[model samples]
Target chain A: MSSIVSRNLKIYFRDKSAVFFSLLGILITVGLYFLFLGDTYTDGLADFNHPEIFMAGWIMSGLLSITSVTTTMGAFGTMVQDKEKKIYKDFYCSPIKRSVLTMGYIISSAVVGLIMTAVVLVITVVYLAANEAIVISAMLVVKMILLSALTSLSNTAMALFIVSLINSEKAFSAISGVMSALIGFLTGIYIPVGNLDEGVQMVVKCFPTSHSAVLFRQILMENSLNEGVKSYPAAAQAEALAEVKDVLGVVFKFGETECSAEMSLLILVGALVVFSSLSIFTLNRKKTA
Target chain B: MNKIVQVTSLKKSYKDVHAVKGLDFYVEEGKLFAFLGPNGAGKSTTIDMICTYLRPDSGKILLDGSEVGKNDDEIRRKIGIVFQDSVLDPILTVRENVTIRGSMYGLHGKELKEAVENACEVVGMTDFMKRPYGKLSGGQRRRVDIARALVNTPKILFLDEPTTGLDPQTRVNVWNTISDLQKQNNMTIFLTTHYMEEASDADYVVVIDDGKIAAKGTPAQLKEKYAGNYLYIVPKNKDSLLNTLKKNKITYKQNIDTISIPIVHTVDSLEILDKVRENIDSFEVIKGTMDDAFIGITGKEIRR
Candidate 1:
């Protein structure tokens, strides 16, 4: 099984074009933030203290969420390519069980997701530090690393279930293209969930990736949000943070109740379990021609 | 001889099409066995069932003594297959592909390294082991595929249309390697091919048509049963030869100046030669070929 996983990793990283395309979603988000969205958010919140740092936190959180989805999808493309080329037939002829091969694909994709997300996190942190936007904390750094790992695992399962249904490279490419185009909206990066229609907001909130984006926002934007609200009275500061969290999608609400960070974590875990089971069932019954 | 594989009344169907109908055959250990059929004649279906890639709808497939699906992992460990298409990773080097396949069978470290090198050597691909699989020519890629299959040191090796797309010379080279693997390693070889000449070299051949076994025997037995040698005579005087044949009531087919007589045995040709010597200018005896036997048993219609 490890052999299969290592083999997948070698082939995936060896293709330079695949690696670049996987990171393309994150690059696009960064470019859009710098060119347009960054100024728009800062100007709108000019009265708030340190609006630039707070908005940077928001965009970087979205970047982290999108990284897990895109890199893992790219990693699972290796399995789809193997099926297209009928290379999976060769593996099935060996002594390894079908379940083992399935796990190999999932684990390799998870590893890729983790690696790419971590790289994005490091780069984001460095850019903020170089600009002297916010003071860095060791605990925050540790929390971000843990959050990246969790998001990768959750998204790996989702990617596996999606990839299991695809049998050809052409179909896989089409799906990947669609995912790359819509992931920003799904994660509330292109249009914040709070700013969209009530119906559209519910759809975004229901998506597990949206919950991941919220969790990342809660952790990454905590310090910046506190600093931005310092000008208000002590009694109003607490209410002001709540208002800002609602406005920026740092937390989601079903109707009247706000979704706690704990609830969002539960959603991520639930997604991991449900999608992993479905993927396993689908792959075991996979029939190759 | 010990039997390595046995299939009894094995059947498989795809929806309304019966791909394999009550097929029964056994392969002896350490011998070359060939399965021959036209396109869509169920040769691949049968091979797939035997290789445990597909399940038979009915009947039993036993490898060594264990039934299929019951002990498939054990059976898989003892057999290796080189599919009709090259299944190795194109981006990976030949050595990497072989090593990964070997590791799947539980070999690791020094053992895996040795196995990869030895398998490459067996197919004369040692020098090209470091090259990417896609970079190799057709014949070289084929040899590397064979080497990958060999890495596990399986007791039986299955090759499905192994030389279907190679040049004639390359086909011969691949055949030579397959022959050496069987001879030197005492491994049972089960293969399917469209080329009758390649099947002719097998110890046993089975021909199937429309999901049923049409013929199964040794090459010599099939030749004798379905194909007969012919005596072709180019007579100096066609009129005289025709009169003599008419008077003697001899069975012959006339094509212009030449007469073809089916020879049941060598002595029949000698007797005909002596009788027709007076009118004949030249005569030749053409031995029956596997190509003739195949066409004679399977008929001439094209299958979709």
Candidate 2:
């Protein structure tokens, strides 16, 4: 299984086009943020004391979620190709257990997700300090890294479940396109939950991936939001922080209850477990031609 | 010789199509066994079950005394398969592709390296091992596929249409490699091929048609039973040849310019040739062929 993992990683990284396209989602998001969305978002928060810093964290958090979704999908392109070309049947002839082969694909995709998300995390921090002129502490960076791992694993499991159903490259490509386009809306990065329809907002709150974005936002914007409202009166600062959290998706509400950080973390862990088991079951049950 | 692979009442179905219908066959140890059939005649279905790639709907498959489904791991460890199409990762170098397959069977370190090297060397691919699989030509790719299959030094090698689409020279090369494995390494080869001439060299041949055994025997036995030996004579005078055959009470088949007479043996052609020497302009004796046997048994030519 380790050898399979190593072989998959080598092939993925060796293909320049595949690696470039794997990161295409993050590149597009960052381009959108740089060319227009950045100013528009900061301008919406014009009255805030530190709009640049807060919006930077918000956009960067969304970028991490996008990385988690797309990189793993790109990694899984190998598995789908193996099936499409009947290469999996060759592997089936060997003594290796079917479940071990499934784990090989799963573990490799997770590794890719983790690595690519870490690269995005670094770029996010650099943008925070260089563009927003905000220097977060080492402790904050550690927390973000930990969150990236959770988000990467959670999203990788979800991608695996979807990929297990696909046998052809065309189907995988279609699923990838749909995933890239819908992820932003699902994570509330393209449209804030408060601005959407109640039905869509309910989906955003219920969606497990949206919780990853919320967790990221909670960590990335913790210092920026506090600093942005530090000059306000004590009572006013509390109200301002709460309002900012709601507006930027740092917190999700189901009716009157605000989802706590613990709940959001639990959701991510739950997504990892539920999706991983589901994917394993689907993969094992599938027979190759 | 001991039976290396045995199937009893094995059956498989694909919805309405019964791909394999209670087929029974056995392959002996260290012998070249050929499984011949027309397209979609359940050749692949049978091989898939024997290779442990698919489960038979009913009946038993035993490999070296181990049941197929019940002891697949132990059985798989002793067998290797070369699929009709290339299955190695095209993006990977030939060495990497073979090495990964080797690792799957638990080969590692120096042992794995030597096995990979030996496999490639056997297929005459040692010089091109570093090249990407996709970069190789069709024939080269076929050789690499063989090398990948040989990496485990399998006791039984199963090749499905191993040379279906290759130039004559390359087909002969692949055939030589397969022959070497059986002769020099003493490996048991179970081959499914569309090329009848290739199956002519097999120790035993089984031809299936419409999901059932059409014929099974040594190549000569099958040809002698289902196919025939014939003598063809182009007559100098058609009327004179007809009179001679009729006067001699020899049964014959007449074509536009030639008459054919079935002969029991090659020497019998001499007797018929002597009788028709005065009336024949040219004459030739044709032995029964594997292709003829295939056509005779299946009632159709082998599909591409």
Cα error of candidate 1 at position A14, Å: 1.3
Docking class of 2: high
The lDDT per prediction is 0.87, 0.88
TM-score of 1: 0.95
Q: Give the clashing residue pairs of candidate 2, or none.
A: none
User: Which residue pairs of candidate 1 clash?
Assistant: none
Question: How big an interface RMSD has model 2?
Answer: 0.7
- lDDT (10s digit) by residue, model 2, range B56-152: 9999999998999899999888988999888998889999999999999999999999999999999999999899999998889999998888898
Q: Identify the runs in model 1 with alpha carbons over 4 angstroms from their true place.
A: A230-241, A284-289, B301-304
